[model samples]
Target chain A: MIYFDNAATSWPKPPGVTEAMVHFLEKVGANPGRSGHRPSVEAGRIVYDAREAVAELFHAPDPLRIVFGANATEALNLALRGLLRPGDHVVTSSMEHNSVMRPLRALEEQGVSLTVVPCSPQGFLSPPDLEGALRPETKLIVLNHASNVVGSLLPVREAGQIARRHGCLLLVDAAQTAGDYPIDVQTEYIDLLAFTGHKALGGPMGTGGLVIGERVPVDELEPLKRGGTGSRSEHEEQPDFLPDKCEAGTPNAVGLAGLAAGARWVLETGVEHIRAHEVRLTQQLIDGLREIPGVTVYGGLDATRQTAVVSFNVAGLEPSEVGLRLDEEYDIMCRVGLHCAPAAHRTIGTFPTGTVRFGLSYFNTPEEVETALEAVRAIARANK
Target chain B: MSYGVVLVPSTSHAIRAERVCHLAGLKVKLIPTPRQLSSNCGTALRFDWEERETVEQVLRANKVDYDEVHQLEW
Candidate 1:
């Protein structure tokens, strides 16, 4: 069976990921920062190493600013709900996942003004359009680095500069591009970056975080939840320091151990190499699918402008039917439906029924892509 | 023997100090925060008083957020 739905969650993670988690469970099984014992110290070290690894991946200045959470959704919530107050204005794009859209919607209802700039039919946002939407009251501009549905990359660097010019903070949702592409928070002038370890980072689920930049005044943003951070236990008020200021409870130490190893692997192997491999596979898949009759592919054919995700529709069949056929007959795994980004589907004109998504990964080979394309061709022929 | 205790304001900083010192090959032991020290963190790093300069240098280089370093009789 071929697995191609990496956008949802990556499969068959790097060998070191599971090994590291197991090592945590066996050798360093203690709550980090909760005790002063040797095991606890070792556990704290593992967590810190993961923080440093995440910092290195994003080129963040300080490791202490990396705050751990359950996933990108949680991280986004922390950033959106934490930073934006009533009467503050925000600018975002139409091609955002529910992770960003839901929180913004909730914030909008709470009297916070929101302006959603529409993306092109191909799911690319215009940086100038984003800048035009910003108001004097606009305190933040949040956007995803890449669309989860169409795989089109946004102009984050330009948007970051615009945000800086307007005195608004730029918060990037790097859910799909964190490990697959190179991102330097400093170079891009990003103020906050939210990422998930389970996807491109190749770690176990239940691990993700937000990396805060130096420009953001963290003290002003309220934490999503507050409790014992194993520091300032004597004081009922939460600690004002970073990491602890955002991280309120016992963290997912086991998952983080795996994340550290996964991040280390990405750094050692280099993101450029991974991006090249995925681009090659994506180009092959897109080219093959476009050649097949009755197979209408979405998104641009440019491999350099997108991640490995490709969406398509076959003639005379619903997306669900095609997905079922691919799974039962071809033994190929992919995602179908709106993909949690209804706004993206609307932008691409696949609103209700959605489309079949084949998200490639670094581990996927050209041979696998070829086989999947053949399966798609056979399905298209049958539908015709 | 005289020992040195490095007190930090938080557990995260203490953990960071330990890691920085350990990587630098400084002989440091993470012990409970002594009653004499007024710190919020539960743990503190204990090292030889003679190695104060070395520990300070390593922590400073690593940017480990520490509070105070005191010389105590053991």
Candidate 2:
């Protein structure tokens, strides 16, 4: 069976990921920062190392600024809900996932202003359009580094410059790009970066974080949830610090241990190498699918400008039906529907009924891409 | 002998203080921030009072952000 739904969640993580998690559960099963015991200290070390790894991956200056969360959704919630207040304005692209859009919508209802800059049909956002949307009241500019639906990359550096010029902070959702692409928070001028470990990071579920850049005043952002962070136990108020300010309660230390290993693997193997492999597979899949009759591929054919995600549709057949056939007959796994980004589907003119998405990963090979393409071709032909 | 406490503005800085001190051969232990110190953070680093000068130098050299260092009995 071939797995191509990496945008949702990566499968078959690196061996070190499982090994690290097992090691944590078996030998260092203790609540990190909750106690001063050996196991507790070990757990704390694991969590800290994971923070360091994530910080290194994103080029954050301080590891303590990286706050652990359940996933990118939680991190996004923390960033959006924590930073935005009533009457504040925010600018975001139309290609955002629900993780960014939902929180912004909720905030909009609470008197915050929102401006969604439209992306091109191919899923690219213009920096000028985003800058034009920025208002004097704009406090933040949130965008996904890459569209989960079409795999098109956003010009974050250009957007960041615009945001900085407007005195607005940039919050990037790196859910689809982290670990698969290079992101330096310093160079990109990002204020907040939300990433999930279970996706491109190759970790288990339940591990993700938000990296806070030095420019963003940590005290300005409110804590999404407040409770015991094992620090400031004597004080009822949440600790107003980098991570503890955002991280409340006992963390998922075991999952973080695995995440650290996965991030380390990405660093060791080098993101450029992993990206090259995925781009090769994506290009092959796109070129092959374009030749199949009755098949229409979305997004540009340039693999260099996108992640490994490929979306397409077959004439006279629903995407769900094609997905079911691919799974049942060809033993191929993929994602179908709006992919939690109806706005993106609408941008690409595939709303209501979305496209069939094949999200490849570094582990996938050329043979698997060929087989999946052949399956898609057969399905498209049969539908006609 | 009284121990020297290095209070930092954040937990990340406290952790960095520990790392830099260790590399500089100054023995330091991370503990809960004493109530006497600022309530800005939860974690603080404790080291020997004799190593206060070296600790300060090392942290400064390593660019660790710290609040203050107090020579206090623990």
User: Mind giving the per-residue lDDT tens digits that candidate 1 earns over A241-298?
Assistant: 8889999989999999999999999999899999999999999988999999998899
lDDT of 1 by residue, B6-29 (tens): 998766787778777888999998
Q: Find the 10 residues in a row with the least total lDDT in model 1 chain A.
A: A375-384
**Residue-wise C-alpha lDDT for candidate 2, range A149-201, written one tens digit per residue:** 98999999998899889998999999999999999999999999999999989
Per-residue error at A151 for model 1, in Å?
1.0
* Most accurate candidate by TM-score: 1
Model 2 CAPRI quality: acceptable
Worst 10 residues of 2 chain A by lDDT: A33-42
lDDT of 1: 0.92
Model 2: how far residue A57 lies from native, Å: 0.8
Q: Relative to the unseen true structure, what is the C-alpha lDDT of residue A248 in candidate 2, on a scale of 0 to 100?
A: 85
